[model samples]
Target: MRYDWTPLWRSTIGFDRLFDVLDEVQRTADETYPPYNIERVDENRFQISVALAGFSSYEVALTVEQNVLTLEGRKGEKDEKTFLHRGISTRSFKRQFTLADHVEVKGARFENGLLLIELQREIPEAMKPRRIAITGAGPGKVSQIEAKAA
Candidate 1:
């Protein structure tokens, strides 16, 4: 499916990235080089696991640019020995995930042929809900409406 964002694109400002992301997602919908999965560990935590069979940790590169997490895998020199029927793939692949505001990458680990990426969403202190201290006007302080009514 495709969407036309002509109206929104013309009037909005600073939303080109969002529109571009949507378009890119549609364009890359058929790209399934390296399988992956995303899971929400908690309200503020997330994990992404990518299946990279036959690829070591040194072959994969993880980077975060703005709110996008990019994972690029580059296999080193191939084995000299030939296989009768090779099945396992160790090809180069690049995958990206768009992160929400305040979300950041915590850490990552490679285990059992899976690259596990940890994410945490840390809202700033000012953005969090805070209780405001209400203060009294002062001693004997009254409104003009009270005097007018009397």
Candidate 2:
């Protein structure tokens, strides 16, 4: 299935990335392997936790390229063991996450069968909001009394 974004493109400017994100989301809608959570730690900090119950840190790989974060888990060969009711999954899985602009992966850690990825958005100083001082219309536009108050 495909989505037509012609109207959105015509009405908005500089939102190409938003459309791309939407497309990626639609393509991966059926993915359910390695359930995860996205939590906002603060205004600019975030954490992504993926449940990898039976996988060790060495069995999982995390990579970030361009603006996409990919997580892959490959289970190692297990010793022959017979289980009457096998439930835990040991299958390999791959997950991808599209990151926004200026969002960087701070770090990653595996704890308690969960893989946690930290993210932080660091806006450049030039891109940050600033107060612009407004001056009089012209050099001589200020009233005499107002100028004396300077």
Q: Best candidate, lDDT-wise?
A: 2
In model 2, where do residues sit more than 4 Å from their true spots? 134-150
CA lDDT of each candidate? 0.91, 0.91
Q: How many backbone clashes does candidate 2 have?
A: 0
lDDT of 1 at 19: 92
- Scored against the true structure, residue 128 in model 1 reaches a CA lDDT of 100
Give stretches of model 1 more than 4 Å off. 6-21, 130-150
RMSD of 1: 5.0
Candidate 1 structure, TM-score to reference: 0.74
Clashing pairs in 1: none
Task: Give the TM-score of each candidate.
Answer: 0.74, 0.84
In order, how many clashes per candidate? 0, 0
